[model samples]
Target: MLKFTLKRLGYMLVVLFIVVTITFFLVHSIPGDPITAMVQDLPEETRTVYLARYGFDQPLGVQYVRFIKACLCGNLGESLRYPGRKVIDIVRNYAPVSGVIGGLSLAIGFTIGILCGILAALNRNKWPDKLIMVIAILGTTIPTFVTAAVLQYLLTVTWPIFPTTGWGQAKHIVLPVLCMCVGPVATYARYMRSSVLDTVNQDYILTAEAKGVSQFRIVTRHIFRNSFLPCITMICSSIAGIFSGSFIIESIFAIPGLGKYFISAINDRDYSVVLGLNIIFTGIYILAMLLCDILMALTDPRIRYSNDR
Candidate 1:
């Protein structure tokens, strides 16, 4: 396990290097200089001084190397648009908001999805199953922004049950959470239903039944355990999906989160913030994948570490 973890860490580092390099070059290649954008209001002499102060007068390669070095030294560079604030400071302030919303949505979605799936599986070919299927289809088909807008209209605008925008109190989170939950819940339900159905039909399940094992024991202890493993992998991979969903939901709801910062960075062409946020998110994703692999090995004895396998 140690060796396997080390290998994965090495791979993650390599990927991070590639991502950083690509992002730096690509952002630099974008039309219109950030220095020009930042200094547009300044006189020509003042603009030249500002550019020199920020080292914008340096060659692109030198700038890239300095940026990489600064990042390595725990400095994500000062934001061009926001001047005195470091990119890292902005990220630190916003990440927690996104984390809270994303984490709550994921938990609620997964729990509801698993319960619904189990019920649908148990009631296959019946109305309950059909109803769940329709819900799953709708959840998967609708775009997240569309769902956010519609929910805002129905729950916030028309009925005024929830606040329309801005995140401060818990009340502000309700609509965004619901919107983020839609696709994940639907996807998880369908996956869980299929897994349960397949597990229930396995030969071991039949043998357990023939031996007169309690139905509850057979289903929960044996079948559910095996059935839920794949869902774990699916859930981990969906971390990226959850974050992406939060981007739209957060922006629409005016939540002060990484999503809002990300959108602002793009619009303002704040490359430091954009690159900093991207790297942070990519680190999170990689860490989640590693955790998923560890959890899989721990849960199923059959899943041996690479050395053991």
Candidate 2:
């Protein structure tokens, strides 16, 4: 297990390095110059001075080396638009809002999905199952921004039950969280329902039923627990999606989060922030995968020991 973890961590570092390197070059390759974008009002002579000061006048290879060195030294480079502010500081300020929004959405979505799936599976071919299926389909089909706008119109504008935009109190979180969770919740519900149905037909489940175990015990203990392994794996991957969803939802709602920062970085052409954020997101995804692997090992005895052992 230790060796496996080390191997995964090594792979994660390699992936992060590649992502940062690609992002650095790609942002630089875009048409407009970052210095020009920042110093639009400055005279050409002043812009030239600014470019030279920032080493933007150097060759691309030289600039890349300088950027990498700065990154290694814990200097994410000064924001091209913000002038003196370091890119990392900007990311740190906004990441918490995204984290809260994404975390809550994941929890609520996963719970709702699991409950709906269990009900649909147990009531297979009945009205309850049909209702859940319809909801799941709609949830999957509708775009998140469309959902957010509609909810804003009905819940916030027409009814005035919730705030239309901005994040501060729990009330502000409600709409964005709902919008972010809907798609994943639907996907998770369908996956869970199918998995449960498949597990219920397995020989071990039949054996448990033949032993005269109560139906509730058979479903919860023998069926649900065993079937949950795949759901657990799905949940981990779903977390990455939650962060991506938060980017869109945050933009729509005007929430001050990492997503907002990401958008700002793109508009200002703050290459350092963009590269740093991408690296941060990639690290998060890899960490989540590692956690899932550990959880799998804990839950399944077959995975607990090294294959070589």
Candidate 3:
């Protein structure tokens, strides 16, 4: 297990390095200059000072090395648009907002989805199963932005219960979170239903039934436990995706999250913020996958971590 973990860690580092390198170069290659974006009426002297100050005067290779080293040292560099503020500070301010909404959405979505899936599987070919599947399909087909808009209209315009936009109060999070939950819930329901169906038909399930195990006990002790293992991987991978997906939701709802800032930074050509956020997103995704692997090994004893053979 240790060897397997170490190997995965090594792979993660390699991937991170590649991502950072590619992002840095690609961002630099963009047509607009960040310095100009930051300071509008560019005086020649001021431009020179700005270039030197931010090390834009240096070669691309030199800048890349410095950027990597500074990042390794926990200095994500100052934002071009928001001068004097570090990239890490911006992330720190916004990540929690995104996390709260994303986490809540995932918890609610997964719980609802799994429960519906279980019910659907148990009542296959019945009306209840058909209804759940229909809802799931709608949820999957609908775009999150459209969902957000509809919820905003219903909750904010017609009813005026929740705040229309902005972050802070608990009420503000409701719409965004609900909007976020739609797709994930649909996805989880489908996956969970498939897994449950496969597990239900297994020989062990038949054996439990033949031995006259109570229906509830067979489901709780045998079906749910075994079937839930696949959902764990889906949940883990979805964590990172949910975080990224919030960009649209956040934008639509005016939530002050990494997603909103990420979009804003790109439009403003804020290089530091863009690169820093990209790296953070990539790192989270890689770490989530690694966590998923660890969880898979832990949940299923049949999954052994072996470096050899």
Candidate 4:
């Protein structure tokens, strides 16, 4: 187990380095200059000074080395557009908002998805099952941006029940969370339904049924637990997606999350922020995968024994 974990950590470091290197070069490869974007109409000499100030005048190799060094020392440098602000500080300010919304959305999604799946599976081929399946299909088919737009129109613009956009109030989170969760709920529901249906047909399930185990106990203990195993990996992977913030949802609602900042950084040619955020997101996903592996090992003895071997 220790060896496996150490190996995973090594792989994660390699992946993070690759992500950082790629993002650095890709951002630099884009047409035009960040300095020009920062100071639109600066005199040539002044632009030279600006470039020198940010180390942009240095050779690409030198800049890359310095950037890597700074990153190793936990400095992602200042935002090109925001001047005095550090990338880490900006991330700290925005990540919590995204985290809160993401956490809530995931909780809601998992709960609703599991319940709906169980209901549908138990009532297979009936109206209840059909209705849930239809809703799941619609949820999966609709785009998040469209969902956000429609919800905003119906709940905010027409009804005036919540604020149209912007952060601060608790009400601001509702629409975006709902919009984001729909897709996840649909996805999880389908997976859970299939898993449960398959589990129900297993010999052990038939044996349990013959033993006259109560329906609820059979479903929860015998079926749902086994069915839930497949979802652990999916749920862990989704954690990064949730915390990253849905770009469209954040933009539509003017939520000042990392996703909003990331988009702005790209458009404004703020390479520091863009590169830093990308690395952070990459680290998040890699870490989530590690957690998923650990979780799977804990839940399944087969995985644990295989690793032990």
Candidate 5:
């Protein structure tokens, strides 16, 4: 176990380095003059100063070496568009809003999804099951941006049932959070339904029924636990994505979350913000995968990492 964990940690570092290196080169290689774009309004002397200070005047190799060093030392550098503001600081400020949205969406989505899934499974081919399946298909097939647009149009533009956009107040996040959770609702419902169905056919379940076990006791005691493991596996595997805010959802709602700022940073060529956030996200995903594997092994004795004695 220790050996596996060490190997995974080593891989994480390598992946993080690759992400940083790629983001650095890609952002720098973008079309047009980033320096001029950033300091277009400044005087020539100030522009030169800004260029030198930020290594905009340096060769790519030199800039890359310096950037790597800064990253190693936990300095993510300042935002190019907003001078003197650290990328880390920006993440700290905006990440919570995204976390809140993601957390709420997952909580609500998972609950509703699981309940509907259990309902569908119980009903089998009845109307409720068929209707839920249709909803699940549509929800999963539809893009988040499309969902956001339609909701925004109907709830805000047409009916004024909710605030048009922007964050603050409970009502503000309703649409975006709902939109973000659509995928989860579809995903969980489908997976749980399948899982429940499969569990229902297991020999233990048949034996329980033959032994005169009540339906509710059989389902709640045996099937629910077995059926939910796969869902946990999915959640563990996708933990990193939980905080990524589904990209454009925040923007559609005009929320000042990390994902929305990330979009702006890319458009404005704010190298520090873009690179830092990307690396952070990459690290999160890699680490989450490692944790997921470890968790699976711990939770299921049937699982093994290697041939170690």
Candidate 6:
């Protein structure tokens, strides 16, 4: 396991380098110059100052080398959109807001989804099963943004159960968290239901039943344990996706998250913020997949990972 983990860590560094390099070059290659665009209406002297401040005055190769060095030293550079702010500072400050909402959403979604799936599977082909499936279908089919809008309208506009916007308070988190939950719950429920059903039909389950093992023990010991192994991947994948995608929900609700800033940075051609955020997300994505692979190997005895590879 140690060797396997070390190998994955090495791969993670390689992937991070590739992601950072690609994002840096792509951002620089964008048509408009951030300094020129941001300061187009300001004084001519201001433009030159801004250019020098962000190293736009230097050649692209030099800038890339500096950016890489800064990243290695844990400095993400200064933001081009919000002057006088470091990119790392922005991430440090804003990440927690998104983190709170995303974490809560995942916990709720996973619990509700997995339980519902188990329930649906236990009642296979019955009314409960059919009803859960329908809910899962709707949740899977509906886009998150649309769900956010509809939820905002119903919860805020019509019912007035929660406020439409703002962060820093628990009430503000409810709507965004709820909106994010819709898709995850649907996905987990459907997948879990299938896993449970498949586990029930396995030879071991039949043997346990034939041996006069109680239904409850059989399910709790064997079925659920095996069925839930798949969810490790699902939950980790959601972690990668939710952090990146939370920007849209944050934008709609005015939540002031990294995603909210990310959108604005893109529009303003804020190279530092964009590149920093992209690298952060890409790292998270790669790390999550690595965790998924490790968790699967550890939890499921049937699978073995060879360190020699």
The numbered model that scores best in lDDT is: 4
Cα lDDT, all candidates: 0.83, 0.82, 0.87, 0.87, 0.83, 0.86
Candidate 6: pairs in clash: none
Each candidate structure's TM-score, on Cα atoms with residue i matched to residue i, is: 0.88, 0.89, 0.90, 0.90, 0.81, 0.89
- The stretch of ten residues in a row with the least summed lDDT in candidate 5 is 300-309
What is candidate 1's local distance difference test score? Answer: 0.83
Q: In order, how many clashes per candidate?
A: 0, 0, 0, 0, 0, 0
Instruction: Give me the runs in candidate 2 sitting further than 4 Å from their true place.
Output: 37-44, 242-245, 306-308
Q: Rank the candidates by lDDT, best first.
A: 4, 3, 6, 5, 1, 2
Output the number of the TM-score-best candidate.
Answer: 4
lDDT per residue for candidate 3 within 127-210, as digits (tens), equals: 988999999999999999889889989998999999989878988889888888888789888888999999999999999999
Clashing pairs in 5: none
- Candidate 2, residues 1-309, lDDT tens digits: the string is 887778778888888778778888898898877777765777889888878988889999999898888878878776776778776787677777887888888898888998898889989999999999899999999999899999999998899999999878999999988888898789888988998998888999889988999999998889887777788898788776544436678888999888777777877777767777777777788788888887787766677776316
By lDDT, the better pick of 2 and 4 is: 4
True-vs-predicted CA distance for residue 231, candidate 1, Å? 2.0
Model 4, residue 176: displacement in angstroms?
A: 2.2
